[model samples]
Target chain A: MSQFFFFLTAIIAVAGAIGVVTLRNPFYSVLSLVCHLFALAGLFLLLQAEFVAFAQVVVYAGAVMVLYVFVVGYVGGDDETVHPWDGPAQKGIAFVFAGMLFLELCLAILGSGLKALDTRGAGFVPGFGSPGDIGELLLTKFLFAFEAASVLLLVAAVGAVVLARRRGGIHDEEQRLSFTEFMRPIGTGTTAEGVGTRDAGINLPAPAAPAAPRSDRETLPTGGERP
Target chain B: MNWFVVVSAMIFCIGGAGVITRRSPLVTLLCLELMLNAGNLALIAFSRMWGNEEGQIFAIIVMVVAACEVTVGLGVIVAMYRRRLPIDVDDMRELHG
Candidate 1:
């Protein structure tokens, strides 16, 4: 049963990782990451690292993925705007290099053998990876590191908020405004003829007012017009 | 189990491949998280085998650190996106003088 569970999660994780790499839509890629992290949590359970598994799901899958989803949404779906031929050769080189690196690591692992590292003491006790044991260690032997981690997290949170909330100086504001205008949907009640034009930086005159839809008059009764 | 090492290696490789070939910064970030999780799996496996609390503790610490990295990294990416900058790794050469 345990082996079955492990295989299940391991396959899910590997497939999700592949999806994260190959999916063209950034939204789908983020979803795949969420799937990958959830499976990782299951793997943690299989290893009996209960606390770490839960933390993996809560932090990486939950919080981190939410942030990623937001960023992907904000950036739009098609952000990889490089032309097809621009860097195909470099991408190919990268794939070959990565494959070679993987082969090296695999060979090293095989050469070293698959046995666990020898230790001075016996192997871990049952429930050693449980939350209670972890909490005890956090408050005792590892208290200093725990507190330091908390401080680091606090600083990170503050830094992210500060960096994101920064209202840049006037020039930045102007640039940002133009970018927003550029990103606005073309047909959102804007009458400007040049708004949807392909030309860069050429603002043509606004088109005439759109004719009122005859369907509106036809759908409403003679005296049932909206006030 | 030996299978743990094998699976971890496979995951590490998949993540490495993703990081190597993916163009978008967001995809690269996702691949990085995959790599980090692969490391966590190996750490936990060793921790389980050793019967020690240290490995699990380190894994938790890694989780905290990964969280911090994602927060700051995504913020920077979003900031760059707002500036109309392409979020491609090759295009992000502003750091190069």
Candidate 2:
């Protein structure tokens, strides 16, 4: 039963992944990625890593995939612009590399002599590493790393916000702000005022109106007309 | 532990190749995800075979990280599309300099 589940999840995951890479539409690709992530989460469940599997589904398949979908949908509305092409040489190289990696994995698996490792007393069972156990371990042994990860997440959030924020346009007093100015302390006031200021030196020239045709009476006369 | 994992790994390898060889950025991202998931499958298989919890833990971490990567990657793709008007990687030469 467990073996069946593992196979099922693996197949689904692989299929989804293939879909993601082969699909031309960015939206579909993101959807396929979600499917792959979900299947992987299920595979983790088969391995008796219930907590990990749940996290995989929730963090990756759920929240992360949705975020991707949202971004794709928001930005990629026109499909006429997307072009796909893989040169034969690039494809050949990729295949060769992938083949080599596959062979390496096979060799490692075969050479490990995994049969010698006894599984009888390994003390692991389905769901043994429950969320509670994971939480305990995370807070105890991996506390520092966990804290660091949180800080990293916070930094990422701030970075994303800064990247997405639109600065002053051409009319603003400062026109362009340096990275250091953007990151300066909020209360500094000097950099804050410059944030939205436009550059006066770079004023855009007014657009010229279309020329009007001259009246027929004002047209230059030909020799025949003068005669 | 059995024929299932071996077969799944093969599928994963195929998916990975497809992703790397594909010209579309979208496809490449998908293939990368597939490869990562395939690794998750192997980890799970080993965990079951060895009766150890570590494999499962690693699999979970991979999934989470994959999710984070995909989100950020997609955001980048969207931003790229807005600036370039097309998603063709071949024509995207802004960063070449």
Candidate 3:
């Protein structure tokens, strides 16, 4: 049963990884990655690293994948099969390099007598790899690293916000009226022209907007409800 | 455990290939995440092999790092999209200089 389960997840992981690379749509690629991560989490479970497996699902598959999905949505799925930089020769070279690298890695792994490593090096301890055990280690042996990771995450959060800040500055209060208009088609959401032409920078001559002072808050739909 | 090592190596190679061949910055980032996860898989497998907590700790640390990387990469992608910049990795020659 264990062997069968491991094979199931291994196949899923491999297939999902392939899907991620071959799928032309960025959204589909992100979904494939999510599938891949979940399979990896299952593999972690099969390996008895229970805490790590849960963290893998929660952090990698859950939070990180959510971020990727949102980014894919925002960027639009403009995945060209070949780009100006990607010549046929370049593709061939990349595949060859990857093949060689994999060969080297396999040789190294196999040469190390991994079969011997199949035996547990450390004696079995009670409640090994449980979340409580991991948390205990985090607070005791790995405390410094634990705190350092917290600091690192905080810095990363601040840096991402700074990087994402608009060039016009955060205080710019002007809102794009078209942003409120989601009724129009967005051109399949896979073309650059889909979202590009609708951003806050371009305006469409007010579009029969009311001249009333309070019309700024009143979008096209709310005009019907106005007293 | 040996199978796990081989699996990870294969996934890592797939990810490396994707990173090299994919032109879209978002797909490249996705491939990078695949590589990172592959590394994490190997680490967890070894952690189990050694029957200790260190490998799992290292795996958790790798996860944190991966999250940080993805957050920053997505932020950069969004910023580029907002600036009307090309989202293709090949066209990002501004960074080469």
The prediction achieving the highest lDDT against the true structure is: 3
Docking class of 3: medium
The DockQ of each candidate is 0.52, 0.43, 0.65
Give the per-residue lDDT of model 2 (tens digit) for A104-138.
76766667777723332245644476988777767
Model 2: per-residue Cα lDDT over B12-82, one tens digit each: 77776876666556556666766776777777677767665566556655665665556556656755654
Error of 2 at A10 (Å): 2.4
Location of the lowest summed lDDT over 10 successive residues in candidate 1 chain A: A204-213
Residue pairs clashing in model 1 are A123-B51, A124-B50, A124-B51
Q: Give the per-residue lDDT of model 3 (tens digit) for B1-97.
A: 7889889999999999999888898899999989988998898888877788788998899889888888888889888988788888877877731
After superposition, candidate 1 runs with Cα above 4 Å error:
A84-88, A117-124, A166-227
Report the candidate with higher lDDT, 1 versus 3.
Answer: 3
User: TM per model?
Assistant: 0.77, 0.69, 0.79
Per-residue accuracy of model 1 over B2-31 as CA lDDT, tens digit each:
677667887888888888788888888888
Model 3 chain A lowest lDDT segment of ten:
A204-213
Best by TM-score: 3
**Candidate 2: lDDT of B89?**
63
Per-residue lDDT value at A43 in model 3 = 93
B6 in model 1: Cα distance from truth in Å?
A: 1.5
TM-score of chain A, predicted model 1, versus the true chain A, to 2 decimals: 0.68
Best first by TM-score, ranked = 3, 1, 2
List per-prediction Cα lDDT, in the order shown.
Answer: 0.76, 0.61, 0.81
- Candidate 1 C-alpha lDDT tens digits along A73-140: 88776846766665768768867877787778777766775355332224557776889999999899
Each candidate's fnat, in order? Answer: 0.72, 0.43, 0.80
